[model samples]
Structure formats: structure tokens, C-alpha cells
Target: MTSAEVTRRRAMGAGLGALAGALAGCSGASGPVLRLRLATGPEGGPYNAFGQALAQAVAASGHRIEIVPVSTAASVNNLRKLDDGSVELALAMADAAEDAVLGREPFPRPTPVTALARVYVNYTHLVVAADGPVRSVKDLAGRPVAAGAAGSGVQVVTERVLRAAGLSGAPEPAPVPAADERPLGLAASVSALREGSVDALFWSGGVPTPALAALAREMPLRFLPLDDYVGPLRERYAPVYTAVTLPAGVYGLTEPVGTIGVGNYLMARADVPQDAVRDLLRVVFDRWRDLLREVTAGARLEPRFAISTGEVPLHPGAVAHYRSVYG
Candidate 1:
């Protein structure tokens, strides 16, 4: 670990220890109560919903760990917050976490972020109106698209998909609206699509996102297939992109839609205590079903799946937790 990483770990350890001591003393409890801040996504997004569910599950698990979910702009923002020690935990896309570790775009330098688990897979949705002129990914060229909220993992993948489709340019400035310039959040993007302000929008989330599912009920929407771009994305970036299928009947589609899928990783700062991590992971795996109820449909959390966090190294606590399970 770098000097900065060591400093961050020490600071986090101190803060956690002090807080736990104070809480124990005040409550006269036998043990310390650990409180951790988890950075999730904006309102009505999968990250936010999942984080809330996880927090609730942890609270009910009879463990002393308290998870406080903090909503932000999603993956990129969450990782940045984790790096700065503002949050102890963050939910991020595999690509964003990879970039943070590799010190890619959006991150100024290599950040010391570690993965606790690979939670679930996020399907990329390139949504357009069912009756609109846009038909395919290429049709989005020169048209206004809500690429995702600023500083979101959705935007990171959206830009790559757009570039792969040959729509290359800096994201449109907020002041000067251009064909491909909208960076709206899930709720706002859905509203914009309803209002016809944006031609299409890019969103990465679990199948049947609440906002989009609700939108589908109100109006006819089409999800353009994006499986073709997955190969290029994987080739260019890390092998974090996969071709996944959205089955029919989801969002009222007549046929299944093939799209790019990325894994969502539950991340932590490098310096968090191992025992705390082990305890948290215990609750996570033990209550995995309850946690996924509100997050996604038809997903499973296993030690095998959780350990495949790609390039981001697992925290020492995570490794210990998994080892205890396997051994």
C-alpha cells in the first residue's frame, strides 16, 4: 500500500474505534456498535434501493453494525467518496471500480479501493420510444440522448457505447444543449423521454428498473439491443462487459432483447477493519435473499460469484470471510 493508503486506513480505523467506544459507553452495551456510511446512487435507482435493502437487512440481522446509506450520483461518485474516506462502503459497477484501481479516466490517480463482493449484474438499457424514429444504436447518432447522470457509472459505459457506435464528441455542455448532451438521472431521464426532450436514454441497472418499468406502463418504449457493442467494450476496457439477454415480457417487450451486462460490486476503502467486514459479509450472505428482493429479480449471492470482482482486489477482510466459508 502507498503512504496515502496507509494514512487513510489509520484515519478510518481511529474514527471507527472512537465512534464504537463512544456508542458502547453511552449505551452501556457489552460491545462496540460500529456505524458505517455507505455511498449509494440517486433516488429511484438500483444502487439506492439495494443499499437501503442491505441496510435494513443488516439492522435486522442482530449484528451491532449499522449501515447508513448516503445517496450520490452513483458508481463514479461513490468510488470518489470511498477514496476520500467520506464513506466506508460504496456500490459501484465493475468498470468504474476497475478504473479506480487502474487510475483511469475520472480518477486522477490509482485509488486504493477494494471489493467486498460482486453483488449482481446490471443490464444496459438503451431506451427509445416504441414509435419513435430511433430504431437501433446507430440511430441515436446526432440525436439528443440522456447518457446518464453526471459522475455516474451509467455515463461511463454510455460514452463508451456511443463511441463504439461512432458517436464521438465530448458530452454536450449543460449550458449549450447539443444533440448528444443530456446527462440526466434515471428519474429525470424517464421524464425527459416522456416529455420528448431527449430522443433516447442510456441506463445500466437490474432488469425492469422501477423508473423504466413504470414508464413502460404509461407509454410504449423500446429497448435497443446492445450485445453487439459488448465485445468492443471488453476489448477496449477490461473484460468486465458481458452479453446478456433480457427475457421477453419484461417491460412489455414482444421478444427478448440482448444487451451488455456489467457486474455490480460492493466496495470498501482499503483500511476498514477485517472483523467488521467479515461480520458485514456474514449478514450479506445470510440475508442475501432479503437484500435482493428490492434490488433485482432472479439473482443469487454465492461465495464463488462474490469473489469474481475482476481486477479490483478483494479486501483482506473479504478474503478472510470467504476463506472461512470455503474452508
Candidate 2:
């Protein structure tokens, strides 16, 4: 709770209110201006990039709608913002959002939010320098590790995966700088990995992440398999995790890496106008091809599985969209 964070929160609040106000007023001729505040993850991560792309798509739809993308720590942070009224729309991991509602780890109490769609799967990448000593999660013992930024979904999953692997205290979690100071979450971790500040990095993101890909090109790297922890993780946390493979050579690796996949959800405050949510869903599902071309991770948002939000309830607007499509 730094002054900088307070100031940023205030600015976001203003933007959300302004958008809500505009959406409240409409004329049959031009329609009302709809402004939405979308809270995304770290600056260089997939959440921020995909959110910006979504905003652009909504803008290009020729509707009187404008989405403002705000960069914040992903997952846990986004749900907090939604609860406090600073963010109208956001992206969160299915597990973290469920935790928020259940007042589980990473959340102090139940947070009310609604899901627009289950957008994509974020694969856990336990990356180490190819020449480094660590070959597996157990090897990370007594080493420094970047376990993801504090208050991020990455951190949430990182901790669970480690605990399930029996390495909960094996490595020291990297110190996270203040929110405003951390522009790119994984970029900082990658820098630490490259500089030997940390021996291994735990990142949860869509495949072919720009920062990781760039790091792979500069130096050899390898992804440690988390196959052993999948069942235990499911037993401890929500069942939102699934097994997935990282194709060989995706990040220039020699063999496919096994990892757990967690779904990413597009979320909103429950009070947001149902019609507005419906329209947003339309932009996402109806024009999904456009999103897929823009964001590689967008390909995971299969319409048939879009409504499979675990603990967090789907927004009424999302329900309407599905009914319109199916019924």
C-alpha cells in the first residue's frame, strides 16, 4: 500500500466510473459511449499483451465501446481490484479466481466476481539455464529461485507446485519490488536467471512467451518437467489444472516438456451491465479468429469449453451469449 499504488488505484477508479457513466447514457442514433477498464498482468507478459489486443478488437468492432487496459499484477491482484471497484474487466487464472471466492490461500476473504469466458491455458514453465546445475525441482534446494511476483497467479501456482513436489522450502523466493516498479514480471525473473541472481525461474504463461523466447535465443535453456506434481497439486488446490505438453522446439528445446496447464478466465464485476458483458463475449467468441491471429494464446479459448469456469460463477451476460449460440 504505497502512495504510488494508491494513486494508480485512484486513476483506475476514475476510468472505470467514467466508462460506467458513458455506458449508462445512450441515444438511439449513435448509442452511448461504453468505456471499460480492463486490468491485465505485468507489462511484458501475455496478459497485458492479450488484453491490449482485446481492447483493440473491441474498438475496431465499430461499436461505441472503448476498453482501457490497466497493467497490474495478474490473478490475485486483478480480483482484488474488481472487488474494490477499480477494474471493470480483467483476466485471472481459474484456480486463483476460485481461491478468491473460497477465501483460500492468497485471498483473505471471499471476493465477488464473474467470469466472461475461460480464455486460455497457462502452462507452468520451470526454466533453468541449460548449463546450470538444476535439472529438476528437487535440484533447486538451497538455491535462489524466481517463484513469480507477489500477488500474481504465477506466484499462486508456483507455490502449490513446489509444495506438491516437496520443495516448498527448497529455494528462496525472489524478492518482489513494488507493483509500480515491476513493469514486466517474468522479464525481471529472466534477467535474474541470466545473471545468476537465481538458479531457476518458475513462470506460468502461454507458450512462446516473448521474454522467454528471447532469453532462449540468447542462451540455451531447458524446461523442467512438473509431471510428478500434477496429481498432488489437484488434490491440494482446485482441479483446474490439467496435463499439457510443450512441443519440442517451441522455445528451441530439443524435446517436448511435460507440464500442468491452468485455464485463464476473462472476468468482470458481477454488477456490470449484462448486455455489456454479452457484447464483450460476442467480440471474443464471434471474432475469435481475429484474436487467434493476434494472440497465440487466444487459440485455447474453445467455445465448447468456454463456459467451464470452476468455482467462480459465469456472468449472466456470458450465459446469455451461450444460450444465443446453443439455443
Candidate 3:
């Protein structure tokens, strides 16, 4: 976890400390002094920016926070980090969260982490070699692709989509050693796709992802519908998924492509001090628009969409805040 800490700490005003401390299980989690740690994804990715915004929002609320901005393998690592107490907050995909909470055999032991809210939907975009024989997703049958980093949420869903699309990821168990996989990094995956080193790619992220955006600028690219598999995927996975469309020209692409995606959520260990969590959510909803303006393409954030996080259960604290703000 490569984390950039947000050292700008502040004191949560007045008597809120004792209240927040009690909820966090702290003896004195008191006196305008609480340093909450947050784990964010890679620098350019949405989570990092979102996490930073959260940290700043909390800080602005006069609470102390130690935001550990990290470049994650993505979802899988995020969940592990949270469950193990490596991080207090993490951005999670709905599918990954489901796998964790259910003890879904192949995934890590099910850990009942609480969800703060489903911030937004992560659109699964498949990019293939523009000049290669692969056009639609089906064309890449029996080929290699970057699912996502091992242990990252990307790999989890990548394999799911492949199976959903009637394909499979490398069957060689532990294809790359876990430790080896750790440093393999996203650049390797992106590079593999660029050189035709792989057949195609399936990434679940917010629209105009840096990788997709970069590839679109460097070479020809297309977003595969894979929507054809959505209905079946939904029937099986159900609530974790929903249809999200990448509007035409979003990536400056000529046509719109519909794909199946899951929501991106902020999750916390159940004991994150309800008062702190309570204050955090209050600030986010109140100044969301201003926060969005800070991230390059974070315009997708809107108050109306903020409460749409039904995919992941809202943090009881967040729900309290939401009810007060929008309910």
C-alpha cells in the first residue's frame, strides 16, 4: 500500500471528541484530537481523490485525520486492508464487498465490514487492441487479458466477467506468486494491453478512467457492451450489479456503450466512532459539489446520486446524516 498521508490535522470542535471517542471505542478519543486513517486507491484513481476529499472535509469540520493515500491493487486489497485494520476506511466495489461478507470460498474469509455509502457506480470497460482481430468482447475468446492486479478487486470482477462472457482467466493457480503479484503493479497490466501483449482488458471504474483515457489518446479504443451478459450476470449476482451507460463522447468516443457495473462504496470497520463518522458524512454531503470540483472528472458526484448507494448498506452514521440532509 503506497499511501500519501494527509498530515493536515485539525481538532474536532468542542465536546464532540468525547462523543466520537465513545463510538470509536476510545478512552478519551477526546478534545478536538482524533486522527482517523483512510486508505485511498492509486493516485490518479477516483478513490484517492475521493478519500482525500473526505479527509479534507473531515479536517475542515475541525476533526483530525491521517489520510493514507495508497495505490491499491484495487478492491481485493482494499477489503483485506480494512478487515486486518491496515486501514480504517477503504473504497470498495459492491461485488467485492459481497464476496467478503459472504465467505465466498475463493475470496478471503467473509468479514462483515460496514458500508458508509455507495458513492458511485464503477463501469466495467473492456479495451482491446484496436487494430487486432478482437472487436467485440466475444472475439477475444480463449485469449489473455488483464483482469486487474491479483488480490485487487479488479481481478475478482475481471474473472467474473470473463466467466459471464463465456471466457476464463489464466487457469494456472497462483499464475504469479502473491508476493510477486504485489509489485507487479498496474503499469504492467496497462503496458501489456498496449503492446497486444494481452488480448483485452476489463476494468471497473468511474467514467473517463485515466488508463482508458490515456489509451484513447494514444491509440484507437472502444468500450465493449458486455451488456449482453448483464441480464444473466444480474440474475445471478442480482443487487450487486446494475446497468450503467458510458454516454457517447464521454471519452471523446463516437458512440455510447452500455455495460454492466457495480457501485463504488466507502466502507469502515463497525467501530469507527459513530460521532466521527457522523460528522464526516455531514461535511461530505454539505460540500460535495465543492469537493467534486477538485478532482478532474469527479463531476459525477451530485447530491441526488449520493443517496443512491443502496448496493452497499450505508454506515449507520452516514444514514443518520443522510436522513437529516436529504430524507
TM-score of each: 0.90, 0.87, 0.79
Encode model 2's per-residue lDDT on 1-327: one tens digit a residue: 332343344334433342355464576899787778999987867888888888889988876778889999888889899888887888998889888766676677666677889887888998989999989876765577888887798888877776655566433255222111122268889998899878888888878777888899999998999877788888877689899888886899888889999988999877677788888888887676666553354365577788888777777778888999877
Candidate 1 lDDT, 1-327, residue by residue in tens = 443564355345543432233232234564767788899999768899889998998888877788989999999999999877788899999999988887788887877778999999999999999999999877776789998999999999998988776675544222222347588999989999999999999999997787889999999999999999989899999899999998899999999999999999999877678888999999989988887777778899988989998778888899999999887
What overall lDDT, based on C-alpha atoms, would model 2 receive against the true structure?
0.78
Clashing residue pairs, backbone N/CA/C < 3 A, model 2:
none
**Cα lDDT for residue 73, candidate 3:** 61
Error of 2 at 217 (Å): 1.0
lDDT of 3 by residue, 30-124 (tens): 44455555666676666777777776666667554444455676677888876666667788887887776655635544464667766677787
**What is the lDDT of every predicted structure here?**
0.85, 0.78, 0.64
Clashes of each: 0, 0, 8
State the lDDT at 235 in candidate 1: 94
lDDT of 1 at 53: 91
Clashing pairs in 1: none
lDDT of model 1, residue 87: 86
Segments in model 2 whose C-alpha atoms lie over 4 Å from true places: 1-28, 169-184, 297-300
